[model samples]
Target: MTRMSSFRMSAWGWLAFALVPLIPLPSVAEGAAAAPVLQGETCSVPGLMDQIRRGLASKSPAYQRYLRALLREAAVTLPGAELQAAFERETDPVMAEHLAAALVARSEREADREAMQVVAKRALEDRDPAVRSATVRAMRRTGALEKTGDLYERLMRDASPEVRMEAATNLVEDNKFVYAGQHGPATDTAVAAAAASSDPKATAKILGTLNTEKLGAEAAGTLQGLLRSDSAEVRRSAALALGGVPAEQMGTAREALVSLYRGERDTGVRKALVQGIAQLGFASAVPELQRLKGIDPGMAPEIDAWIRALETGLQEWELILREKQRLQQAP
Candidate 1:
C-alpha cells in the first residue's frame, strides 16, 4: 500500500476513514452503544449554528426568537415570530433582554411596532438578572444608551447579586474609558523588550504581557531567531506569541511558520502553528498550506476557508494599490 493508504489503515486511520464523510465519525465506544437520537434541540455537536438557525425559525415560539438572536449574531439570521416569543420566554432575564435588543436591531419600519412592544415589555419587567442585563445591552445597541442609563444604575443596585454583577461588568465594559491607565508605560516597556528579546523565554514572557500592538515590528525582527530556538517549549511559546503580528510581517512569519510546522513534530506546536496562521491571515502561506494538505486532509475545509479569506483580502489589497497608483499618476 502507498504511504497515504498505509497511514489510513492504522487504528485511528481506520476509524477516521470508516465514518461518514459529511458528519463527524463516531467516538470510540467504551461500553454501551450511544443513545438514540430522540433529540429536541440537542447541543451535543460543536458546529450547530446552522442547525439552530433552522430550528429556531420554525414553529417553536420560545426556542425560535432565542435561536434567531444567536444565529443572527453568527451571520445566519433566522426569521419569524417564534424567535421573538422565544426571546420573551427566556428565564434568564439578561438573555431575554439581549434577545429584546437583538430583535429591535434586526426589525425594521413602523410595521414592526408589535414586535417592538414585546421588546419594550421585557425591558419594562423581567425578574431574571440576565434578562435585565440583556435589556440594558439592547437599549445601548438601539442608541438609547443615555435613556437607559438610569435603568442600568438601578440594576447596578439591584437586590439580586447576579444583576448587580452583570450591571457592574457591563458598565465597565461598555464605557471603555475606565480601563485606560490600568496598564500603561511599564506594561508597554515590558512588551517592547519581549518582542525583541534575544532570549526566547524572555521574549515569550514579554509577548505574554501584550494584548495588542506589541507584535508588529518586533515579531518581524525576531521571526528568524524564534524559529531556531533550541528549546521546544520556547519555540512553541514563540509560535503562539506571533499571533496578531502585523500583516506586513506575515510574509516573513509564513516562512518561519512552515519551518515550525515541518521541524516541530509536537502536537501542541502544530496546533499553535495553525492558530498563529489563522491570526496572521496571510495569503502568501497558501502554497505552504496546500503542501500541508497532503499530510492531513481532515483539516482541508478549515485550510481552504483560511486560504480563500486570505486570497480575497490580498485581492482587495491589490485593487487598493492599483487605485492608489492610478491617482498618483493622474497628478
Candidate 2:
C-alpha cells in the first residue's frame, strides 16, 4: 500500500468519527446562545435600561459581558438618565471606558448638552487617559468644544499623545472661540505651542487651521519654517498654507515656496510646493518651475501643466487689474 493509504483510518475508526456528532454536548447557559440576537432589541429605552441594569447587577462574568455588549449595541438610543446611571454604577475601569464610549456615541446622535457636559466633566476628572480621550471625542462630536477653549488648551498639554492630539484638533476646529475676545491670549498661547510642538500631526493640524481661517499671513514665518520639518505631512501642510498667504505677503511666500521646492526630494512635497507656487500666481515662478522640470523626468509633465496654468492665471489677473485701473482713470 502507498504510505498515505497505510496512514488512513480503518473502517471502525471512520465509523467512530461519523458517530461523534450524535453524542450529546454540554448545555450552555439558558440565554447565552441567543444573547447577540436579544441584544439587538435593546435599541428601545426600556430595553436598553434593562440591559444596563442587568449588566450592572449581574454576578456572572459571562452574563455581565453579554449585558455590556447589549448596552454598547443600544448606546445610541440610550437616554441621558440611563447613561448617567451606568456611569455612576460602573466601577471597573475597563467597563467604565466602554460606558464612556457609549455615552459619546449617544451624545453624537442626539444633541444632549446636559449629558455631554456630564461626560465632559467626567473626562476632565478621569484618571484614565483612554476615558479622557473618549470624552474629548464625544465633546468634539457634540460641538461642545466651541466654548471650552481653556479646557481644550489644558488637554493639549496632556501626557497622553492621543488626548493631546484630540485636544489640538478640537482647538483648531473651534478656533473662533479660541480667538474671541478675552480668550485671545490663551488661545494664541495654545496655538503658538502647537506650532512649535514636536508632534508633527499637531503642527500640521494648526497649519491647516491657519490656512482655512485665512490667517496664513499672520503665521507666514512659522509656516515657512515648517516646510523644512522632518515630517513630510507637516511640510506638505506648510506648503499648502503658504499658498494662502495674503496678496501683500505673496513676495516672501512665493520665494520661500520656490526655495523649498528646489531643495525638496520628496515627490509629494514637491507637488505641494508646485501647487502653492501656482496658486500664488507669481510671474517670476515660471522660470523656477521650468528649471525644476528638468531635474525629475516623472515630474516634468506636472510641472509643465502648472507653468501653463500659472501663465494663464497671471494673464487673466493682469487683465483684471488693468481694467480696474482704466475704469478708475475714466470719467
Candidate 3:
C-alpha cells in the first residue's frame, strides 16, 4: 500500500522538518509498578528470569503480568532471550504492540544491536503491518542503522503501505546529517574533519550526496584519497561517490578507479569499485575488467553486468541529457 515512489523530502527539507520543537514525554517513575515476583524477588535480570521461568512452567499470567509491568516502568531491559521466550508463549496476539515494542524500545535505549536485529527480522516477516511499522521506527532510533540499512531498504517495498511508508521515512531522516550540505569552504572543512575523525562508514554516507563546483572538487579529491585508505569502507564509499562528481573529473576518476580495482583484493570493495566504473568509467576500462574477470572467473558474471551497464547506461544518460538540453533550447 505504501509506495516507495512517493515524494521524499530533500536532505535540507528533512533537516528543517527535524528542527521543529519536540515535547519531551514524562518519564515513568521506577516505583510506578510493583516489582514482579522475580528471582531474588526484584527487578534485576536473575529475578526477571526467575519470574519468566516460573510463568513459562505454569503458562500462567504471572510472567505476562511481569512483562507488562516492565513495559509500563520502562526503566530496565529484560534479557533478549527471556523477552523473546515470553513473546513466543503469549497466547494473546498483543505481543506485537506490547512485547515486541518493549523489546525494541529497550534495545534502542540500551543501544543493543542484537536485540534490535531480532526486531528487524521480525518486522520484515511479521504478518501485521502495525508491528512492522513500529519495528522500522525502532531501527531509526538505533545507532545500528548502518549495519541494518539493507534490511530497512528491503522493507521499503513491503506489501503493507504503512510499513513501507515508515521504512521510507526512516531512510530519508536517517541520512539527513550526511546529505544536508551546501557548497562552501566551511562545508568542505566540516566534511574533511568528519571523514578524518568519524567511522569511515559514516563518511561513506556523505559520499552519496549531490556535488557542486566547490564541494564536487573537494569531494573528488577527498574521495580519491579515501579510495586508497586502509579501511575498505572508506574505499567503498569513495567508489560509490564516483557517480556524483563533476564531469571534468570523471575521466581521471575512472582511470584511477580502474587502477585501484586492478590491485584490489576485498571482494565487497571490488564489487563497489566495479559499480563505480560502470557509473563513470569508459569503454577503455572494459578490456581490463574482462581481463580481470578471466583472472577471477568467479566474478565473470558480475563483470559482464558491469561492462554492460557501462556500455549501455552512459549512452542512454547522454541521450537523455541531450534531449533535455534540446527541449530547453526549443523554448
Q: Best by TM-score, which number? A: 2
Error of 2 at 15 (Å): 60
CA deviation > 4 Å runs, candidate 3: 1-194, 208-215, 282-285, 311-331
- The global C-alpha lDDT for each of the candidates, from Candidate 1 onward, is 0.50, 0.62, 0.56
- Cα misplacement distance, residue 6 of candidate 2 (Å): 78
Compared with the true structure, model 2 gives a TM-score of 0.51
lDDT of 1 by residue, 145-239 (tens): 23232444344445555544444344333333423313332223333334333444444543432333334465345544665666565566667
Backbone clash total, candidate 3: 3
lDDT of 2 at 241: 67
lDDT score for candidate 3 against the true structure: 0.56
| Candidate 2 residue runs with Cα over 4 Å from true position | 1-125, 141-146, 150-157, 168-196, 205-213, 216-218, 282-288, 294-298, 311-331
Q: What would the per-residue lDDT of candidate 3 be over residues 1-331, giving only the tens digit for each residue?
A: 2331121123223323333445444447755755543222224434443433445455668756545444523323346677666644443334444555566656656645466667678778877677777656655533434445457546645777676656545543444443343333433443353355334544555454424324556656776777888888778867866644567888778777878887888888888787666655456557767877865566777777656655543555445335434543553
**Residue 296 local lDDT, model 3:** 58
